[model samples]
Every structure is written in C-alpha cells, then in structure tokens.
Target: MEQLLLNVVTLVTFDGAVNWTVGFLTTVAIFAILALALNIQWSVGILNFGVAAFFMVGAYVSAVLTLPAPEGLESYVAGWGLPIPVGWLFAMVAGAVLAILLGIPTLRLRDDFLAIATIGVAAILRSIANSVEGLVNRSRGLNGVDGFLEDQVQGGDYRWVELAIALVVLLAVYWLVSRATASPWGRTLRAIRDNEDTAKASGKNTVKFRMGAFMLGAMLMGLAGAIYAHRSGTISPLTFSDLLGTFFVWTMLIVGGSGNHRGALLGAVVVGFFWFGTPLIQESLPDWLGSRVFQVRQLLIGLLIVVFLLWRPQGLLAERDRVSRFVTRGPDDRTRGGDQGSVWERLRSAVSR
Candidate 1:
C-alpha cells in the first residue's frame, strides 16, 4: 500500500495536475461561450447549422489580422500583426456580417430548409478554406498565432494566466447575455420563439426579431473562435469540423437545456468532462478498447443525448418562468417561500391591463 501510494504521488506531480486542470477549464470556458451563443439563436427558434463555418471565419480572420507578416514560402495573405483585442473585435463583426448575409436570403425559409442551407454554407466554407491556397495557408493552416498577453506572462504560470483571462471573458459574455435576455427585447424574442403567431398578432415583427437574435448569437460564436485561436496558437480547416464545432456544441445545449443561460454553462462543463476525459483513462483499458476509446466516448455521448431527450427533454435545467418586472412585492416578500399566488395574480392583472 505504501509503495502504491508513493508511485501514484510520483507519477502525478502537482504542476502537471494544475496545468491539466487549467487547460480543461479553459476549454470549458470556450464551450460555455459557444453554448450561450447557441442558446440565443435557439431562443429565437432559428435552426442554425453553419456554426462551424462562423467559427472558422472568426479563427481565420483573427489569425490574419494579428499574425506577423509572412516570410518566404508562406502562401497566406495579410499578417498585419495587430493587437489581440483588434482580432477579437473584428472576428465578432465578421460573424454578424456573415449572419446578415446568410440570414437575409434564408431567414424567411422554413426551419428544415434553413438548416439545409446552413449545412451547405459550412461545406462551402470548408471547401474554400481547403482550396484557397493563397489565403488562410490552405490545409497547412496559420501557425504561431499570438496568445493573449503572451509577452507579459511566461513559463508554467502562463497557463494559469490564460485560464483566468478565458474565465473573465466567459463571465463578461455571460453578464451581457444574461442582461440582454432578461429585458423586454429578450421577452419579445422568447414570445416569438414560443408562439410566433401570437407575437405577430401582438404587433411584433417576428422576422426582424429573429434576425437580430441570429446576428447576436453569431457574433458571440465569433468571439469564441477568436479566443480559441489565440489560446491554441494555431488553426486550420480541420480545426473547424462539423462534429467538433457544431455537433458537440449542440449536444451541450440540448443536455444542459435550451432557453436557459445557466443551463448552457452547466451543459458545457458536463460535456467538456466526457469529451476531454476519455483520453486520460484510455491507457487503463485493454489495448483494443483503448484504441477505440474515442468511438466509445462518442457512443456514450449519443446515448446520453437519447436518454435526456426521451426522459428529461427539458434538460438538466429547464427554462425559468418569466415574470413581469412591474409586479410589486409585499413587505414580507423576502421571508415568503415564494409568493406564487400573488405573482400569478400580478401577471394576470398586468395582462388584463
């Protein structure tokens, strides 16, 4: 027993454990941002399938904007070597612009049709990135992309610094998203999502509201991509695969529960565990099983999705009930368990008015 304990302690150094943890949390932060962005789109009832494409655009745009000038034999264009924040800002702009261009033509289509169009868009983007040798460095991808504050931080400590920065970005995005979603504009969006006909009858322009939501969601997705690129320090067409970029994110949202921002964050952390955990335990399994561990991990994820959909479709966290902000509270409101009756009465009274 003493020998086994000593061996385990020697194998798992404190620094190694901390670095691994930081890397894992950073990935979760990225996923949380993506999930939140997707939640916005889902709230507006848009079935966007081109999320990977938007992510690729943001990565490449940020890479190009911030990269140093290419040397001999480098085929990619535009390495302006700008600051990282500039890259992040323009990545968002590119995403929103792409959304507008795509949304304008296809937003009016039915959900299924829109989904197909978006899939095609992702494929087209992938093909362009692959074939355009003069731009984005073709399949070779852009390398040596700058890290956030790399100049200021060095050595093993940089991982912790980057993780902190990633968390800060995640929190900022969460704050902005949560604030936006709780406002009247957000309520209108939810109203449109839940019942478009009723929202239309209420004199809301459903199409415009949907377009706005889509743009906002895409912008956040772009920001996520930028953060990912800077963190990883390299990117390629392969990095933006539909499976990794699209499917996994959708799974996170579905599992966490759609329409709830907190659910989105929870789902990201949960999915990130399985997605990143498989490799760690692979060595402990039989050789054949270890070799196919990724397949097993994917199968497990599929099973989880099926289970959640059939039994708990609302997800681990269901969307919260929305109450009117104008509802007044009694003096004992803080002590009350929850004034369900009065809350409903206020809602009814407000609706009647």
Candidate 2:
C-alpha cells in the first residue's frame, strides 16, 4: 500500500502540472461569459437550450477568421492578418447574426417545442461544422492561429499578467450585465420571461425583446469563445462538442446560480476547479484505481446535477427575487414562478379559485 501511494504521488509530480492557477482563472473568465449569456436567455427571456449552438458558432468563427489562409483557400478569401481583438469582434458579430436567425424560427414556438427546435439547431450546426471543409477546414480543424495573449507577455511569471487581464474582463462584464439588467430594456425582457402575454399587453414588444436578449447573450458567449480559442492556440469542431464542452457551460451556469452575474462567475470558478482538480486528484491514486477513476468522477458529476436539480434548482446563489423586481407587480403573482409550473396545474388552480 505504501509503495502504491508513493507511485501515485510520483505520477502526479511527473505529469508536470501546468500553471493551474492561471489555467483555472482563464477558464473562469470564459465560462462566466457563457453563463451570463445563458442568464440573458433563461433568466430574462425564458429561453433555454440554444446556448451551446451560439458558443459553437462563436468558437468556429473566431478560429476560422484568425486562421491563416490555407493553400487552396487563398484563392477565394484574403487573410485579414488582423489581431486577436479584431478576430474576437468578428466572432461577436457572427454570434449576434446567428442568434437573430435562430430566434426568428424558434422564438415563436412555445417552451418544449422551442427547446426541441433549438436542440435540433445545435445538432445541425455541429453537423455542418463537421462536414464543411471550406468553412471550418473540415475535421482537420484550424491550426496556427495565434494565442490572444501570447504576444502581450513573455517568460515565467506571465501567468500573473494573464490572471490580471482575466479579472479586468470579468469586472467589465459584470458592470455591463448589471447595468443592462437594471435598465428598462432589461425590465421588458424580464416581463417577457415571466409572462410574455402580459409584457406584450403592457406595451412591450415581447418578440423583439426576446430576440434582442438572445443576440446580446450570444455576443457575450462569442467573446468568451474568442478568448478560449486564443487561450488554446487552436480550435476544432471537436472543441465545441456538445457533450464535452457545452454541458460544462450548463453546469457552470446552474452551479453559479442563474440570473445574477456574480453567481455565474463564482459558479464558473468553483466548477472549473472541480472539473480540473478532480482529475489531478485522481492521478495521485493507485494505478489500479486511477484507471477506473474517470468513470467514477463522471458518475459523481451526474449525481451532483441530480441533487442540485432536486434540492436547489435555482442554484447555490440564486436571487431571493429576480433582478427585475422593480417591474414586478405582486408577491403571489403567478409570474413569480414564471412559466415553470405545469400549464394544466395553472389552469386547474385558476378554475379552482
């Protein structure tokens, strides 16, 4: 047993830990942006399940745009030779456009139907990415794109600089989201989320508001995607695989407590640590145990999701009241729970009363 323990410890040390503090902080910045995107949709627009598609779109756009012209492709499009910032901006614009297009078809549908449509859209997007050689360089993926910050700093202690930049971006996003949610535009979005018909009757353009929320949310997600692409120094269709990457974003948003940016950021950091830390911890176990640890870890993650859904569906730091409290009418108003209650139950309650 002692020998086995020693071997495990040695493996971890030998594996050579990357500067995890920097890696983790970078992940936090990325997922915090993603969670805020979802918050705009789910918390403010009552939309769900389309975030993955937006993220994938953003990633692909940034990667493809930043990629140097491949031999044959040079004939058709000129390489911009732009910096990562410009690439990021392009990605955001693509995200917004895609969001508008997606919203046009799915936003008109009711909840479950909308979810199905959005999931289908995500699948379609992934399929196109996998098949389109001209667009995403097919299955081979984008290579040689410069890391966003690689040129900005150099040498050993650069991780500190990376952390500082991430913090600054995080703070800026917090301010933006907070201000938007506090604005009248945000109030309209909340009303639409809580009660679309009421919001429409109250002189708000519900459809337009939902679309705007989705587009803005998508823009944030795109910014994150751009950062991630540069952070990794390359990207592939596989990078945005719904199972591997998209689900993690969902986990971060849920764990952080949707609706509030701070909760999203905290949730992202906590979940990012767990996602990376678990594997590190497992690597230190006996070889016999480490071989099976991945499966066990996945099982635990699944269990955690189930438990959180049942006991804390709103998440760890969910608001006691939503951010749009000023526009809210009453305490017992059905809008309090929004569209979460079963339609039949709502109807039955109305009839009973």
Candidate 3:
C-alpha cells in the first residue's frame, strides 16, 4: 500500500511538470510569433504600437467565427461556427486590412508621431471592444472557445498537441520572415530603415515598403492571437492589455535583436521565462510582495528592459550583417582565409576571438 501510494504521488508530480512545461512552451511560441511580427515592421522602420489592437482583433474575430450562435446570457455579433482554419485565415485578412487602413495615414509620419498614432488606435479599439455590448459580448468576452484538436484529444494530452501546432506555426512564420529579410526587397527595406532619405534618393518607394512590412507584421500578430485564443480557451478585454500585448512584445524584440529574426525568438524565450516563471516564485516571497504579484511581474519586466538598454541594448543576439550572396564576397573570395563556414560559424568565431 505504501509503495503504491508513493508511485501514485510520483506520477501525479511528473504529470504536473509535463503540463506546466507544455503550457510554458506554447506561450513562448505564441510570443515568438508576435515578436517576429514586430521585427518585420521594425526592420523596415515602421513604428507599430498597435500590436495589441491587431491581436485583439484576431482573437475576437476567430472566437466569434468559430463559436456557435449564442444561446442564452451570451450575445455577440456573428458566431458563424466556421472551421478553425477558416477563422485563422479570416483573422489574418482582418488584421491586414486594419493595418493597411491605419498605415496609409500614419506611415508618413515621423517615428514618434507614428507610435503615438498607433497606440491611440489601440486604445480606441480597446474601448470599442470593452464598451460595445453587442461586439464580442463586451466585458464578459467569448468563453467556451475550443482548443486546437480539443475534440480529438482530451486531458493533458491535448496541451501537447496544441504545443506542437503552435511550434509548427512559429517555425513556418520564422522561415517566411527569414527568407524575406534575405532577399533584395529586404535589403531595400533595411536601407530605408537605416536612412529613409538615402533610400528615397536611391529611387525606392519608402512608403510602399513600409506599408508592406506593416501589413505583414499585423497578419502575423493576428495569427498569433488566434493561436493564443485557442490555447487559453477564452479571451477578454483584460487579456490584450498594453503591458501584455504591446510593451512586452516590444521588449522581446528589443532584447532579442530588433533587425534579426533569430533575436526575436531568443528574446521571446528569455522574457517568457520571467513572464511565466514569476507566479511560481511568488509563493516564496514575503506576504507584502506576494500580495502584489501583478505589480511585481511588471517591475521585474521593466527592470529587465532598463538593464538591457543600459548595458546591452543590441540584445543577446545582434542583427546579422545584411549582405547579398551574389554581390558580397566571402573571406576566401576576398583574402583566401579558407572557408568561414556558415553565418553561425562566423558569428561564433568572431565572439571567441
């Protein structure tokens, strides 16, 4: 009897650990997607502060589309009961549309003005979502939202499958953005970012390039929002707060590496560690500190941003040098220093030296 009880306890603990890990990783992948979206826009010098607006739009859109028509005590616009993929697709379209609509006017503004405009847009959207009772059921929000593969899988096993889905989507977006950044178009975008007047002097349409980057980033944020909605099984106005939706993602991009996609992924993981891990540590904190858990999390995150900005603002992974394979010469071609191997190898060699 004693042995059996011990075995049962161990099994339960192990199961809890697995569930926690799966949840953490799924959250990280979602944030990575958001961070990548920001990286895409920021790479081309579009200062988008309305990430939360697009994210909220995606979640509400997906939830409304997938959910069945409200029965009683539940009211919202358009519960189409569509398939999840269809919801995801339309969410991306909605986000892109919103981006283009806003970008047309705001993209021409200076950096500070653009940020202020985007943030104001986010605030407007949040108010609309919160005050409009007919839309998204207002403060109550849409609940009973289905998880990815929830009908096919049950219990903790479902989380693993969801995590797999999130990771797959994350990798697909990563590959897409990485390829885009390595192309001639990406080169032009970066040139515009580094110096808009110079890029314009070189005959590039700066506005067009910036608009493209803005829409693409918004679409990715929409996708991430859809994934997040499904994972949480619910989303409310509070979920898309400026801190969680906007500032946190900005920090991820800044800490990861603004211009580099890999930096975005790394920053997501690092910030995610603190974002999710703090709740666990809160239990050990003194009563005064433990009571203000939310504030404590914000403090830690703010402190992290400050420390990184003061010391290593380029982030843990700096952006790679943008060079065309067809135009730029490698070490061997330039000075016969054998092969420098891949980009990673060169970075490692430089760091070691």
lDDT of 3 at 274: 75
Q: What is the lDDT of residue 170 in candidate 1?
A: 95
Per-residue lDDT tens digits for candidate 1, residues 1-353, read 00101122223788656666777888889889989999999998999877898887888899899999988777788899999999999999999998998898888878777788778888998889889878888888888998989888876577777788889999999999999998888999999988999999999988899999999999999999999899888788888888778878888998887888987898898898878866776668899999998798878888878877887676666564655656566445644322435434533432353
* C-alpha lDDT of all candidate models, in order: 0.82, 0.68, 0.82
Better of 1 and 2 by TM-score: 1
Which residue pairs in candidate 3 have backbone atoms (N, alpha carbon, C) closer than 3 angstroms, thus clashing? none
Which TM-score value belongs to model 2?
Answer: 0.81
Q: Which stretches in model 1 have alpha-carbon errors above 4 Å?
A: 1-11, 325-353
- The true-versus-predicted C-alpha distance at residue 302 of model 3, in Å, is 1.7
Q: Distance from true position, residue 218, model 3, in Å?
A: 0.3
Q: At residue 211, what lDDT does model 2 achieve?
A: 80
Clashing pairs in 1: none
| Model 3: lDDT to the true structure | 0.82
User: Is 2 or 3 the stronger prediction by lDDT?
Assistant: 3
